[model samples]
Target: MTHIRNIYCIGLNYVKHAAEMGNRVPEEPLIFSKPTHSFVKTDGNPIELPADKGEIHFETEIVLYIDKKPDPEFKVEDVVGKIALGIDFTLREVQTKLKQNGQPWLRAKGFKNAAVVTDFWDYPGTDICRNTEFSLVKNNETVQQGKAENMIFDFHELIKECDENFGLDQGDLIFTGTPEGVGKTEDGDEFILIWDGKEKGRFVTNLK
Candidate 1:
């Protein structure tokens, strides 16, 4: 795997996800980030999470891998070389408190192994991708599903926002927000990421 330079994440990008979180659809992308230390691949080994942190929730999302710095007028096809399904694990109670205090989400969202992704596949261009549906199965149950078409800020828009605000670098990653149906996780929970109706990756949880 390429060494990750930075990890950027979008919030409230999905319409149903916004509603489920009791948040209004954002006019622009609500951006956040996780540290590189949080990165982990879904290699079948158990993923360790904080056990004492109250209620960690799973947010399944489509992750984009930037191959190089994008040009000013770059399209999604120009910079994104690969794609994968990932989970943006969150400490629910900690995140709630952080939000109430108007604080950054790093503490709640940037824990170790919090950013989990599958092995990437070559991006098949935006047309096919926009129509593709990806899903997450938790403990043998389909918990969340999403497609790029439902994003409030689509892939192009997201890349533009990142370039304009954060300046995209090679190996940077973006978690393009999650869909609705996010719920609490537990010890021994297993997560499977399915794309194009095939199991792409999976990992079991080990709360510590």
Candidate 2:
């Protein structure tokens, strides 16, 4: 397994997602972070989540894996060494409260095992990535679907934002935002992450 360093996430990158969340689409990429402890693999184990915590919503995203420090004139194709389908689990109630209080979203977004990723696969180039569609299936029903072309801030722009502000390093990950159709997750819900119409990962939920 590749050692993960930083886990950067983009919120409201998709226009429809922004609208569904009742927020206007931003002119720039909305970036956030999840602690390293939030990372988890899709191994055959149940993902334990907070049962008492208000509704937890699932946001499926296309995750990029940085293999090395990028050059000043790095090409988007050169920056992403691997790709995977991942989930940005959100505690909706906590997030709303934090937003209302104008607080950082770490408490609502950075819980343990909050970031779930599929097995890494080689980067399939810009054209393929733009054309590929990824989705999340909850209990055999497709809950969320997204394509790169639908992104407001494309991959190149996202990389630029991260590098300019946070400085990307090898082993850093970017969870490029989710699409519409996000909903509440219940205990025993089975989630299957599909990339390019193929199943890449699956896991069951155990809300405690």
Q: Clashing residue pairs in candidate 1, if any?
A: none
List candidate 2 stretches off by more than 4 Å. none
Q: Provide the global lDDT of candidate 1 against the true structure.
A: 0.93
Per-candidate TM-scores read 0.98, 0.98
Worst 10 residues of 2 by lDDT: 68-77
In model 2, which residue pairs have backbone atoms overlapping below 3 Å?
Answer: none
Q: Return the number of clashes found in candidate 1.
A: 0
Summarize candidate 2's per-residue lDDT along 118-204 as a digit string, tens digits.
999999998899888899999999988889999999999999899999999889999999989989999999999998789999999
Cα lDDT computed for each candidate against the true fold:
0.93, 0.93
